[model samples]
Target: MPAVCAVLAGAAACSGVPAGFERPEQPVPTPEGYVDASDPQPISEIAWRYGPAPWRTDAMGDPRIEAEMAGIPYAIEFYGCDQGQGCTDLRFVTRADLRDSDDPDKPASRQARVWQANRWNLERRFGKVSAGEEPGELILEMNATLAGGVTRQNLDAWFDWWRVALTEFQDFTAR
Candidate 1:
């Protein structure tokens, strides 16, 4: 009995785990050069990087900015009760068509594959994806109120996700 207790205590000490308890796994660190979206600065940096974008007003008269990523154009729409409290939304239109058929109702296999690849890549980092007005357009939309207002981190993360998704989609759709 004494030998058994000594053995158990020795095992615990070596493993740094309590008796009958498992040690938790350490979290994997973020990859090097990867932007920490929650850090805030990355988002602002992206906005500055894409400066000189064309500006316009949305239907609600809110300001919007147009930019491009991976050869795809997108719009950044702002929404808020007042200028001081608004958030931004990203709208992206892909170059790929949903289908080659003339019928709008038919789903394009190639388009679907690209969309799925984009969806998988983006969803892992950002969130859910919804269909856009035109086929092949993807909207990674967020409501200011629901998202607790957009910050620089949000914009940075969106751009980062776009960069990754663009590469992924291109690879999947390559000839």
Candidate 2:
């Protein structure tokens, strides 16, 4: 009986599982045209960097930026205290007639796919993202607290990053 017990222990040790083996890595879908926000440009210097083609203030007087890929539009609207108070939040939004499908499940399923894909990419850069839907739009939004008091310099940097990140996200959704 002692020998039998010893054999069982040996067999257990010999099993294929490693002592610290974790689950296999699952494949994740990466958004096409996704840009890493490794090097961010300060907002104040944006005019000198990009030549000011698609960036402008919207009708509401908030800063608005646009990005397009495959003829699809993606926009970022910045909101915060007036003047150089700095932006506290930004919304990345896209609109599609997902509800046009006769089958109700189709829109919901598509929304879920977009949400999942964008969520994965956004989380990598900005940590947690709040995702949801409006009447005719899908939105992924993030809020941030500036390390220092809201200043024009910080706002510029934040906007610059948002433009690049939102453009990348828009490209991903276009695919």
User: Which candidate has the top score in lDDT?
Assistant: 1
- What TM-score fits each model? 0.43, 0.37
Tens digits of lDDT, candidate 2, 1-175? 9999999999988876885564435322223432212111233234234333265667766666564433446555556535423343455454443332345544445456566546656566742233345432345444544322345555556556655655655554444
- The candidate scoring highest on TM-score is 1
The residue-by-residue lDDT of candidate 1 on 1-175, one tens digit each, is 9999999999877977666565335323435554422233343357546443565566665556566665655555554324422332334334444443455665555566455647655555533344455755434433222132344565566566666655554554342
| RMSD from true fold, candidate 2 | 14.4
Cα deviation of 31 in candidate 1 (Å)? 30
In model 1, where do residues sit more than 4 Å from their true spots?
A: 1-45, 48-52, 82-96, 100-123, 133-158, 170-175
What residue pairs are clashing in model 2?
A: 43-156, 43-157
Residue pairs whose backbone atoms clash in candidate 1: none
TM-score (C-alpha, index-matched) for candidate 2: 0.37
